[model samples]
Target: MTQAQPSATPEFRRVAQRLRDDVTGGVYAPGQRLPAAAELAERLGTNRSVTERAVRLAAAEGLLTTRKGSGAFVARILKRIPRRAAALLGVPEGSEADGTREAVEAELRDMGLASRYFPTMSTERAPQDLAGLLGVKRSGKNVLVWETRVFAVPIGAQPTDPGTPVELIRTYLPLDIAAGTTLEQTDVTPLDIRGRLAELGHRPTEFTETIEVRPPLDDEAQFLGLDTDNRVVQLTHSTTAGDRTVEISVSVFPAHLWSFSYRWTAS
Candidate 1:
């Protein structure tokens, strides 16, 4: 009787796992080119198609990267877990004005990493949804939109490879509140939005964040250097000072490079 053929699923997984082990165990160094699919199949005793699937699976896991016209190569995985920053949420009590941003930069500095910020400001009418959230009539009154790009510098990196683009932040505030205030500046503010609002007699009382996971848009993918298979974490932040919504911000972070943690009393 003919022997039953082994299922391709298990074979594929086995090949992928073996390659993953090799990569993780330093058999293949970071940025090192992986064996060709045909060669890998011959060595692993699997067919070329199964080996190719295995490589693709590894790439999806962020363990490898495939370039068009070039074969798969090991990815340079950042091993350190990034420090959690509440900047996306708001400033904390007893912290300095721009404490949120400072805190994040400090943490990166501590880890021998560097950071750069690019800030831009513009005046635009609030979108329908944002206007509703801010309790403003959709009558085309302009709002201040401030965008900042946060980049993380790798240690010993050259100017040509200065750093990795980490996060994109966009903050929105009603024009009446932002006009004539530091919030309208195109430069980094000495304080965060909430702090600046407090300076204007608006005491920030609460903030609510809504987080969603979805595929990255084309622009986001390009800016973050994310592979086509990767997704991103998009967060919408709303801060209220008593009865008024003082600020609304949206931040996008690469899923592979960030995580969030929260602490609260069990009251």
Candidate 2:
């Protein structure tokens, strides 16, 4: 296809990048079946084994999916969605326009894809590691944990994918601020937690987030419909009010399905 690449790059990696880039570059559409292995190898000036390895490599990164009977196809998922860094100087009254992350559903709708949220709630204590991150004391009846699976469909998708979730949101909150509230029992959203916390006099003055990428855990892999080999983006977020940390959330995004963007403003 393109001109020869640097030989320093492994042949397989170069082939893999070309396959991934071609998908993103629209040479192959999402859910579109790729040409046969022989054809692909011929186009790339390689043999079938190298082409197969490249496909597997790209699939592990979530760029494509392979079927036993059917051929490899570009992943039947949203390949591009902006995951902007959040800036929460203060919780806005009625909207999240204060530079904080916008809702995923809104982002999908803007991109013209239908989306849904499936949530599960729980009452629990923060683990030692998470307790340290949240800066919350573990003693007493004070931890609330919940997770939501966000599902969205790409336009003109195929039967291979239906109601598949691209991301999972898990959150932890100190019960002291939300002790006797709906958030304690019902499925709640990140923004909803922010609004409720602000109502209880815990408006955020600063937010902190860190990202890591690795292979998905067993359950995470199954729940998000990803192959165990796929890379996943883990986002750890915290909201602080003055000196108090009221909320912490970790979002798991399948790397094959989404990409993130960051913005900075001079203060």
Per-candidate count of clashing residue pairs (backbone under 3 Å):
0, 0
The estimated TM-scores of all candidates read 0.77, 0.76
- In terms of lDDT, the best-performing candidate is 2
Candidate whose TM-score is highest: 1
Error of 2 at 218 (Å): 1.9
Off by over 4 Å in 2: 1-28, 33-47, 67-71, 93-99, 103-106, 133-141, 154-161, 185-187
Cα lDDT tens digits for candidate 1, 76-192: 654443535343334454233234456667667776777767778888889888997877667876688888777777667787764667788888888888889876655544246
Writing each residue's lDDT as its tens digit, candidate 2 over 20-119 gives: 7887788988789999999999988788888888887777777787777998888766447766655445446433335444555567768767666677
lDDT, candidate 1, equals 0.73
- Cα TM-score of candidate 1: 0.77
Candidate 2, poorest ten consecutive residues by summed lDDT: 88-97
lDDT agreement of model 2 with the native:
0.75
lDDT at position 104, candidate 2: 55
